[model samples]
Target chain A: MKASPMVEIKNLKKWFPMKSGFKSKSNLKAVDGVDLHIYGGETLGLVGESGCGKTTIGRTLIKIYEPTDGEFLYRGGDSSEGGVDIFSLSESKMRPFRREIQMVFQDPYASLNPRITVHDIISEGLRVHSMGKSREERKSMIAGILEKVGLRPEYMYRYPHEFSGGQRQRIGIARSMILNPGLVICDEPVSALDVSVQAQVINLLEDLKHDFGLTYLFIAHDLAVVKHICDRISVMYLGRIVETAETDQLFDNPLHPYTSGLLSSIPVPNPHMRKIGKREIVKGDIPSPVDPPETCRFVKRCPRAFDRCCKESPSLREVSDGHFVSCFLYD
Target chain B: MPKFFYKRKLDEIEEKARPVHINSYRQLVWTKFKSHKLALFGAVVLIGVAFFTLLGPLFVEVGYEDMDFSNLFSPPLTEGHPFGTDELGHDVLVRVMYGGRISLFVGFASAVITTLIGTIVGLLSGFYGGIVDRLLMRFVDVMLSIPMFPILITLTLVFGSGIMNIILVLTVFGWMGVSRLVRGLVLSIRETEYVMSARAMGVRNGRIILRHVLPNVIPIVIVSATLNMSYAILAESSLSYLGLGIQPPMPSWGNMLQRAMNYILGTTTGTNPWWLTVFPGFFIFITVLNVNFLGDGLRDALDPKFVSES
Candidate 1:
């Protein structure tokens, strides 16, 4: 938690030009004007509704999709200028960046390649980056990484089909961590898992982070899960970060109206604690990202939206130390 | 001590272990495949015969080159002779094995080359979809519609004979049907959440196709490929029969049968041997049937869709 920042994004925007109708071309903004910092040894829990650009932000940070506009800074980890603007470099220069900042994808079932043996899947990153020297050395290193991920070494020869969902996730985690990357974007790492298995994975990730001194950009829609692991949290609304703060601060005293509503809506265990439900309910469905609103992306459904909120798009700004919010009410 | 040793070994193995299934599809399909004794036997026998036929001639000193006129038409299993001698008195069984070399090579090699080309192109075209899919499929359809034989004939007529030429034609034109089959495979496998998960993992498009989509289609390609080789052998035989395939002195079964047809009729009618046509035809039937049987076994073993209700 005391370590310096490892990754930085400045006004990153990712727009997809998807032409759906037989007649017209439509442009959709999947991740627009989002900026956040991930410090080494810290987990940045990015929570939001489905289709709220959580995945997009994670991807943009990883350089899978080129940010349509903005600068991505990577420092002191995987060789991209030790805090260099990642988006500025060509793909040839991005190789080490990819190796250093790996991704533990959301779906364990799909993240690993089914055709390849678990050994090969784990070693593929090593091969591409020329990490380990000999085949035997790579095998040993892969075995070691697999063990670190709580999988037995012999699983190296087995195909992806041989593993259960939890084991498959461990394989995915192993594949990402095989390179011993400093930053791993765990995109909803345990969302696809059974409820009982989620805690085990969370524990495993915590152990791995402590052991390896790894940083995680943990993305999820479940507020409770994110609260469990994330030191700092960010809530997104339609491709924009609505609010960001430390976990305790956000839950204890939510500044953004949306954050407060999300917390109040979480099912409390005690039925006796029930006051008349003054919990703010989000009305209306998520609007299509295509040709989104020019002003506040969530103004139509925001409880505190005013005349100014409708006319102007709020920029992400520091409302307090280590806390940021993008809303005219905060302004 | 042994048990402890084994337990430690098992524990170490388990640490680097795969999640094992207590009950699996193994007992089912594996038994089914083995039960296909004819197919299983065919695979083993054909593999053995093919190994000898293909690799045997390379090692042997005297080939179809050595001619013995006095030994010509010697009845099979004669003194110090087996399967008799031909008109030139060349060793018949040796020539037959050598002939199998050429026939099996042209068949299997062409089929493999064709199937690889088809599956790769089809997987990319179908999985990506849109204008690419339309164009590629249409091209495949056009290639399929054209009479494969005439085109092959024209190609052979232009390119001439030998194993290389035959493999070239088969690879170039033989991919059409396989491409269609692979396109269907890709179309379905692409829908699996696993593939989408790969894309989400930041895996590149090429890597996703090769790693995620291609392996599932391998069983289909493997089965279809063996069958295609059988067809390829027949095509080559027909070419040889028409005097367009492997030129004489190369010792193809088709040319041998062609040369022996007159003698076979003569043996039935007059004094020449009737075994000529019978021998070549027998070899051809056996080779095709064996390859088909192997393919059937593979299909039964690998295809999840073909799981027999036990």
Candidate 2:
């Protein structure tokens, strides 16, 4: 791993204000004070239940949804000194970085435009950036990228409707990869695919990451899928990250109760082994993010919650050589 | 027989193995449109009518105003009077052709103006979507709430009916529907993932609206414009029928119909000259009906969900 992080998010916050009454207002804190570092050439998996702000983190990083507060430091090539604070830059100033950070959307059907052909969809970024000199040159470039993404070059002329879900996803991957981005945010890329087709898309992503020397922030609810592709994994609850560690270390010795509960919920294939394995199912629905109490978010759901867990929120702290946890039990 | 069958089977396999031919967006729409038999028939009839009105006047010797005292009120199939003559000895054939030119021009010009205003308003209103949306929508509501026919009549009366003034009145009353349709479409399309993806690529707002958002709204605009053309033609006819549209000396399908009413009631020559009334009314009916069919075909063909079988 590189000595310095490629992207560092510090105290990131994204709150959506709601109109509770004519005069009264409340906020839904989708991502509240999230701090993360994504090193170059490593896949960092972000796993959480639905509406835990995993997708919000990814979107804010790409500036799709502007951060309410915080510094998003991005260290490009040769910028070892302090990096550029992406959140502070204006949109025009952020143009070059948009080419460097691309995203693979969750829904393949919705991501690709139906009116245009695959050639137009893939070449859109290139045209915006003025990467190719001529139309013919851009066509050849698109054809080449299509081949790289495991799609036939001839499919470039076809409309998006002609393709299956898996094929459309491959096209989405091609769209992001054509720019040769440094960080590719995969937001539930395979969650919408059939079980039989999920592994195929995951393998394609893994293969492309290796080929391009790309880093990824893989956001998914499936731990099994993330386990196969991620080097490190971060578990989040509500708007805060509860734990993060090396993939093997985090799986072997789960620090947070939430992490342990998540691992236990993954159904074992062996019928006999299921009886031996202990289940630690966390109780109750995830609390509403709107006007949440200023205490640990997991207190109500945590089976191991005690007095200290309710009185105050726990900040993420390094507990071992590399593993970090935010639970009061770790303290 | 076995050898011949074997050879044919091999050829069939080769044919099946060939690659699928890719069609562009335009080609797909064209193919889908071509398959609708009524639309195709309508398109052909419309094209013929347009050409006749536009070019037939150049070839005809008699002008619409030319009056023949000896041939006044002559019936059809008479010498040099295939469509016969009106009460004033004006050739009905020449007048109908000349009226077509005015009616078709008004329809097309008014449709173009309405589409332009509607699309711009809708794009700006939907894309910006805060104060702009509220203000524009309220204005559209105000415009829509006003009874259109009465306002059109009042405006035509005030403006003093000429071709330009009638078109201006029609355009003012006509654009609200298209603007409302386009605004509704744009509101949904603005939230679509493809549009978000385009914005994330750092494409400028203007470029995104034009390239990504506008293309999706185009099908609705096309359908609306076609409907508007028919509406404009009908409105002009009605206005002219009441003596508040394209004044006499200038032939329009509307005034010609009005002129034929005299012969129908036998107020002028005591003879019901069916040719005068039939020709002008027929042209108006044919043009409006065919234009509507073309619009219906376009709506189906341009739908993204529409799957062309082959």
Per-prediction count of colliding residue pairs?
16, 0
Off-target runs (Cα >4 Å) in candidate 2 are A21-23, A275-277, A307-310, B1-36, B58-62, B66-91, B145-159, B258-278, B296-310
Q: Give the per-residue lDDT digits (tens) of candidate 1, residues A135-220.
A: 76677677677667787778777777777999999988887777767788898999999998899999999988888788889999
What is candidate 1's CA lDDT for residue B77? 79
* 10 residues in a row with least lDDT, candidate 2 chain B: B1-10
Specify the CAPRI tier of model 2.
acceptable
Write out fnat for all predictions, comma-separated.
0.19, 0.34
Chain A only: list TM-scores of all candidates.
0.95, 0.98
Stretch of 10 with least lDDT, candidate 1 chain B: B1-10
Every candidate's lDDT? 0.77, 0.86
Candidate 1 ranges with C-alpha deviation above 4 Å: A1-4, A77-82, A130-143, A303-309, B1-39, B45-106, B119-168, B180-217, B233-289, B296-310
